[model samples]
Target: MRILVTGASGWIGSASVTELIAAGHQVVGLVRSDAGAAKVAALGAEFLHGSLEDLPALHAAAREVDGVVHLGYVHDFSRMDDAARIDRAAIETFGDALAGRGGPLLIASGTLGLARGRVGSELDQPDPAVHPRVANAAHALALAQRGVRSIVVRFAPTVHGAGGDHGFVAMLAHIARQRGVSGYLGDGANRWPAVHRLDCAALVRLAIERAAPGAVLHAVAEEGVATRDIAHAIGDALGLQTVAVAPEHAAEHFGWLAAFYGADAPASSAVTRESLGWTPRQPTLLADIAAGHYPGD
Candidate 1:
């Protein structure tokens, strides 16, 4: 199989490309810049130079590939509308190219804001009115009606690793260092789900290779690591105190992280594991943090 992976130079996408290539599949990595192109080429993938808005290029690339792993998204948190528009356009473009062709299209979605206070399962449909990304995933799933084999892989927020993880965990450490106290919302009872990067990559491979059309997969390894526990871990790493901050002051105290750090986002991947025989072998979230992955120097 020749897989077209958008965001192939990114953290998860890069790891996915490596896994796919190791499994004997040729990879076409979509890159928008010279640096991105070089990065993909170094990983032994052919590069298609274009952004998600470049539908003509994306369509052409999609037409040539055996499968697609749509992993690219504009991560402009302050401008979510832009991200939504780009994501919807990318999905539409990919769907148009692959419709009636029955090639697999794996779309990336997230586990956050799925279920309010409960654990989200693979079967829990996204609230149509809420997160814009949910609708984007729905659009990809609808492609199955047009004969495209589309699967949605909703990722846990924190994809932690020992090397080069600049995501939530790293941001938390930065915040703790700046504030001098690691803080959590209210009683600090809110939980956040997490997965190791390699484990996430392996699950993506399984979805690409064997997932059913319109299948919804949750890439959650450690379903929920408590917010207080996370604060404690960060404090331990930074030699600071883990304290509780009121929910109203989360944004003021934690900066941009307040919205996410306050979410109780436990998710389950049991069905994914049973369906694909994929068990996560990576270190637990706290273990990864404790292993000096989120260093405070």
Candidate 2:
């Protein structure tokens, strides 16, 4: 099968390209820049030079491929609505093109802000009308109605690995470096879900191949890694103390990341594993930290 992958140069998307290629699938990776195109080509994928705004190009790309794995987003937190708008438009453009085709359309969603103080699961429905991102996922899932086999793969907050990660784990390390201490909210009892990046990529591949239309998949390796333990790991890496800070001061100390790191989004991937026979074989957060990935410069 030939797959058209958006954000093909991104962290998860690039990994997915490698996975798909190894599985003997041809990939046409959407790249907005020459460097991105070169990177995708280096991964043995054909490059489609276009951005999300180029609906006609996106449509053409989708029309030519057997499936799509959309992993791109603007990612500017301050302008979240802008990112949401772009996602919605891209989904609409691609889904419209793939309508009545019965091809797979795998999209990236997340477990954050779904619910608080509870473990989010594949059985749990994100309020389709609630968050803008949630609404976008709902829209993509609805494509199944039009004969497009759309699926949403909700990833955990922390998708960690050795390098090139700008996600939660990297943010925590950067915050610890700036603040001189590794801190968590209150007693740091809240939990955050995690997965290894390669494990996540494998799940995306599995979903593309086997997930039923409109399936909502969770890519959570360990259900929940305690925030306090994460703080300790960061502290151990930076040779600093792990301390508990008041929730109110989390913003001041941890900056923008404090808002997310302070959240308790313990997500479960039981359904995903049981349904797909997927198992993650990567080091856990604590073990990865202990492996010296966060050593000082």
Candidate 3:
């Protein structure tokens, strides 16, 4: 299959490109900058120069590929509404190109807030009213009805690995270093799901190859790791104390990351494993953190 991967220079996208190429598929990576193109080329993928805002470029790339792994998202949390708008437009553009084509379109989404106070599963439907990105996931799933094999792969909040992981876990580590103490929110009982980056990349490859239309898959390896435990791990690594911040002060302490650190969005990948014959054979979250890979040695 010839796959077009948007955000191909990104953490997960780059990994996915490597996985696909190793599986004997041709990959065209969508990149926005010269450095991004060089990164994609270094990964042995043909580079398609464009950003998510370029609808014509996106449509052209979508139309030219056998499948698309849409992983591009504007990560500016300060302007989430604008980011969501761009995501919606990009997905819609791809959907229009792939509509009635029976081509697979695997989109990256999140499992956060899919279930409240319980382990989320593939069966949970994303509430469109909650987050605009969740709504975008719903819209992508609807494309399946129009003959597009659209699958939404909801990633765990923390996708950690050895190299270049700037996700939530890295943020926590950075914050800990800055504050001199590793902190968690409100007794630190909230749970966060996580996966290794390579494991996540393998799952994306599987979804592109075998996932059914409209399928929602979880790329979680560890269902939930407690916030306190995560804080402790960071503290241990940095030789600092682990402490808990009151819920009221969570936002003030953690800033934009407070909501994520305080969330209890545990998720399971049992169905994803069984359905796609996929298994995550990587170090667990705590193990990865303790392995000294996160703090950059």
Best by lDDT: 3
Q: In terms of TM-score, how similar is model 1 to the real structure?
A: 0.96
In model 3, pairs of residues that clash are none
Alpha carbon lDDT at 149, candidate 2: 94
Model 2 over residues 1-297: C-alpha lDDT tens digits?
889999899988899899999998899999999999999999999998998878888888899888899998888888989889989999998898889989999999999877766888898887877789999999999999999999999999888877677787877878888888888888887899999888988998888889999999999998888899998998998899989999888788888787787777899999999999999998887888888776533
Which residue runs of candidate 2 sit more than 4 Å off their true CA positions? 295-297
TM-score of each: 0.96, 0.97, 0.97
What TM-score should be assigned to candidate 2? 0.97
lDDT of 3 by residue, 114-202 (tens): 89878899999867999888899999999999999999999999999987899898998988888888999988888999999999999
The window of 10 residues in a row where model 3 has the poorest summed lDDT is 288-297
Candidate 3 local Cα displacement, residue 141, angstroms = 0.5
- The positional error of residue 163 in candidate 2, measured at the CA in angstroms, is 1.3
Return the candidate ranking by TM-score, descending.
Answer: 3, 2, 1
